[model samples]
Target: MAAAIAARLFPGRIYVASAGVRRGSADPFAVAVMEEKGLDIRAHRPHTFEDLEDMNFDLVITLAPEAHHRALELTRYYAVDVEYWPTADPSATAGSREQILASYRNVRDGLEKRIKERLGWTPPVSA
Candidate 1:
């Protein structure tokens, strides 16, 4: 969702990608939720943070608390700004299909809001 919003709002200004601490397939619920807002996450694949080592970024935004700590530790080897976003883990939510999907949607919405505000970009509307 962050990547999609960034792509839509900032175009080429920032390069956005997402990775998990451990590699896992993209969550179906995540795809459904983002689709609700017209963001297609269907092609996203989970990546390891190590895969990002070769890339250069001006900023690293960690949406999960654990990732924040790890990103901080990783940043020592490179010079870049890292910010913790403290977003909830939608996968941890337990409920029926509808409820679980709602959680994911909330996460997508939260990320979109945070990214727009932090990056000084305009909010994205459903497309």
Candidate 2:
């Protein structure tokens, strides 16, 4: 979701990639929440840090404690900047359908907000 939001917000200005500590499948709730914001993550496949094709990145923003630690380890081999955002994994949230979606949406919105703030992104003016 962070990659999707950052890509949409910055487009050609910067490159964005997202990965976790381990490979996993996409979350249906995540796709739904992203769709709510007009961002499609239905095809987004969760990958691990090892799956990255290129390691030449300027910055890597990790959303989980494990991922943050894994990313810190990467600094030993790659010259990259790592920032931890301490995001909660909404997949672990237990509730009804709407409640589950709400959890995912919270994560989506929070990630988008942090990305915009960290990257200095502002919506364009309507003329």
Candidate 3:
């Protein structure tokens, strides 16, 4: 979701990728929430950090503690900035479908806000 939001917000200005410590398919709820904001994440395939072909990122943002630890270990030899952004795992929420979706939406919205703020991005004026 972060990568999708960053890609939409910055377009070709930056390269953004999302990887996890554990590999799994993109959650349907996550895809739906992103699509609500006009971002398509339906094609996103979850990959582990080991699957990254390039480790040349200028900045690595970790949304979870395990990822932060992995990022630190992986980037120790390189001069990359690693930031840990603690986020709630909406999948842990227990509720009805709509209520559960609300949790995912919260995560999506928080990520969007943080991405824009941290990247110093303002939405381009739509003409």
Q: Which tens-of-lDDT digit does each residue in 24-48 have in candidate 1?
A: 7778998887777787878888776
* Top candidate by lDDT: 3
**lDDT for each residue of candidate 2 in 8-87, tens digit (9 for 90 to 100):** 99989997788888777788888888888898888788898898887889899988888889889877687788898989
Query: What is residue 79's positional error in candidate 2, in angstroms?
Result: 2.8
Give lDDT: candidate 3, residue 107. Answer: 90
- Displacement of residue 84 (Cα, Å) in model 3 is 0.4
Q: Which sections of candidate 1 miss by over 4 Å?
A: 123-127
- List where candidate 3 sits over 4 angstroms from the true fold: none
lDDT of 3 by residue, 75-126 (tens): 9999999999999999999989999899999999899899999999976789
Winner of 2 and 3 under TM-score: 3
Best candidate (score: TM-score): 3
Clash tally for model 3: 0
Estimate TM-scores for all models: 0.87, 0.93, 0.95
Estimate the overall C-alpha local distance difference test score of candidate 1: 0.80
- List pairs with backbone clashes in candidate 3: none
- Show where candidate 2 strays beyond 4 Å: none
User: lDDT (CA) for every model shown?
Assistant: 0.80, 0.87, 0.91
User: For model 3, what is the C-alpha lDDT against the true structure?
Assistant: 0.91
